[model samples]
Target: MALELDGFAVLHRIGANRAAFEGISSEVAKVARSLLVKLLKDKRTGVDGVRAVRAALGAEPFALVVDGLTDAEIKSIAKRLDKHNPVLIDGDAATVRKLVGALADGSTEPASRPRAASRGNAKAPKSKKEPTAPKTIARVSFKSAGATRGR
Candidate 1:
């Protein structure tokens, strides 16, 4: 189905019920947003289409993305993100656009933590102070006139 907007188009196909999938799960939202971004990068759709998608879903793209989408739509979006056993239906063009907007705005998720880059030769942290230890006597003995019973 054509998304209502002029520059939007659904990029994935799924087998789900739009109404049933009202509240978006994080996994679904992430995949939807990611796929939306991928669609933006595609040459077929061009920049205008990408911009339009980003605008529609600005604050809550997942909400708008799944507006008319059913469970079938969910499966469709899922398939586009996945590489195997693709979903059985297509996404609503309008929803895809909104999803892109939402992904760009980033209202739903925080930026992911970047992985620590591995170094071939990493240096250990330098020590600020030398390691010091306390000294202790092996034993203490009291010497008195007859304290030990023998001088």
Candidate 2:
């Protein structure tokens, strides 16, 4: 009898195949697959949440199946990981450990605080000086200055 596997199962198999091609041990690949499945199954961290994890695993010197994770995404992932919030899955200590270990060398570092622009600090600061009344000018009549309506 043939066993039927779902889309995600197929994807995991593909990932395992790729890992084998890249010389990654089946055990590490299995751990990565399980971690990915856990993350995907979680309600909070869906497809978007998996992005950082995928990027970190697929980064240079590892180069797993998933690639093309941008620097911004990496930075955002690092930032999230740095927060150390227990409420979120990414912030969970165990998940983080798995993620770091899956990176092949645990070289992925948590990103520092984001830049001012990222933190929404781009708005100009409000002026401290009180508003002054508008300067008033004497009205000048256009007719007196030889300015006519028609040339």
Candidate 3:
């Protein structure tokens, strides 16, 4: 499945079986969720699979390498992740890893695009105004009577 996350293009491919853009498979979805639950303890490595998938969405990747798993394994994981969400990537593991590295190294711009106003209307003109200083609140103090009695 193809989706966007954290300003990155995400492709969640499932298992060895590739599916058309119809939707997610039930079995794949369950397995992917299970893997996520198991790896939740370690966010960095656990989420590496998904991150690798994110890399594939970039225009160009920096290197062709994955951190823990082999390139094929990571691609397989990407497939599994696709079950939960559509991850549409037309690249290999190396491409994905390179993109991931580029993002981390700040070599490439973030995946988020500058969104245009969806309203299809031009922005209103801004009126110039003088900057005003902040107002300070005055404090009031009252002394309590030493002795007080109910009448």
Candidate 4:
């Protein structure tokens, strides 16, 4: 029977029929299921299957998949899906590996050598100025000569 569905359901159907999603670790599947469920609940059912899978696996699990699976197997799966739907590979293998390494190190920033100073070669130590005393203004007050001024 034909059914009109999209997103994860379509992926599940493909997996069931062609076994395209075989060899995916249970941990990765669990993460994918959770993400898919959230997406479905949010009414975001239009996401591409390949992109959703990549996002669900994230950098770490995607790296594991690349390391564990053969190129032919990966290509076979992509080819099957590509025939019927759009396939989007997020980044190159090197970029995915770099992201995995960054995640493992608990850092989100990409690794790069420290850059040399752009302008001044050496930075001078900043000097602290001594506090100055507050200046006081002189005030003059005159008393009235009362009755003596009239005399």
Candidate 5:
């Protein structure tokens, strides 16, 4: 912001208003939600993941990097930022951690990890559990107050 203010002053001083664009650079900034979701207390590490985020967003991140910062503090900051800037700021620390992880480990939608094929058979795992529910009791009450036996 300070840099922007200084640049604006410089532009106005030199009579560069007419040439100036109404907006700044055009980078589509995703709210930092996904990147922040990468944060994990167990995965605390260097700024490699943060760098990946910067590379992805094409904008310098307004992030709480997990270099020396504690996970609790980062989580608090993230929540607070969400509260303060409901529209703009959004991040899940787990995502930030994952970004770092992908940066270090690399990315691939590898088909080698076989996904389970859905079974058309109703007897399969999805439907099998449905039959385990408690059996409901049905009661047949007499219509007449004094009556008891067969109708």
Candidate 6:
């Protein structure tokens, strides 16, 4: 599916119910905006943005963000950035929506904290697989290079 993170121009591309997409996008944006606010704090608001973002997207997503991004995706996005103008840089809503739904529905559970190492016990509890949101790429083009003349 063609995912449009900025402006949602191709929202219909996902084939999900329109209402559902709207709702999901709203929730995703809520979590993202809160995070941005926290990361770029305004003194007048005096809000702890990170905590607020965590509460909105839940602990798992927050932890994922805290854990940081992969070097590969970062490099890819950086390379793409050189070619395109960045209007908005936020989490991919479709991906984030799926994550939120998984979290809400309990289909995907967050990883458990590691147990303290013991000398007698060498084996550790199996860690639940960490959930991931799709990396927000830097280059998102609205139009193709070739275009028809005005009618």
CA lDDT of every candidate: 0.48, 0.49, 0.46, 0.47, 0.42, 0.45
Count of clashing residue pairs in every prediction: 18, 0, 15, 0, 20, 1
lDDT of 5: 0.42
Candidate 5 lDDT, 9-115, residue by residue in tens: 65454445543543531311122233355543225433454445456544433233443345555554333322332221354556534433343333522113336
Q: Against the hidden reference, what TM-scores do the models get?
A: 0.24, 0.24, 0.24, 0.29, 0.19, 0.21
lDDT of 6 by residue, 1-151 (tens): 9865764434344335656576477766566555543452333321233335556667676555533434433323222322121211344543443433333334544334446667775777799999999899899685876777897
Model 5, C-alpha of 131: deviation from truth (Å): 90
Question: What would the per-residue lDDT of candidate 1 be over residues 29-99, giving only the tens digit for each residue?
Answer: 67766676456445465334534565665546535544535555544443343223211234455544444
* Model 6 pairs in collision: 38-49
Query: Which 10 residues in a row give candidate 3 its minimum summed lDDT?
Result: 79-88
What's the CA error at residue 138 for candidate 2, in Å? 79
Error of 2 at 45 (Å): 5.1
CA shift of 14, model 3, Å = 40
Model 3 Cα lDDT, one tens digit per residue, 6-91: 42122333334455633667755555444543442233442444455445434232122234446665555444433232222577
| Top model number, TM-score | 4
Instruction: Estimate, for each residue in 1-151, the C-alpha lDDT of model 2 and write its tens digit.
Output: 9977696676577666874556656665576655654554455763345556656655552333222234343334433444542323335444544443343244543344545545565777877998899999998777768756786
Model 3 reaches what TM-score against the true structure? Answer: 0.24
> Model 4, range 1-151, lDDT digits (tens) per residue?
9976687676667557655556665654677555643443243332244345457667665555545544444434333333232222454444444443343334543234346656676677779989899888776554553436544
Poorest 10 consecutive residues by lDDT, candidate 5: 25-34
Clashing pairs in 4: none
lDDT for 145 in candidate 6 is 61
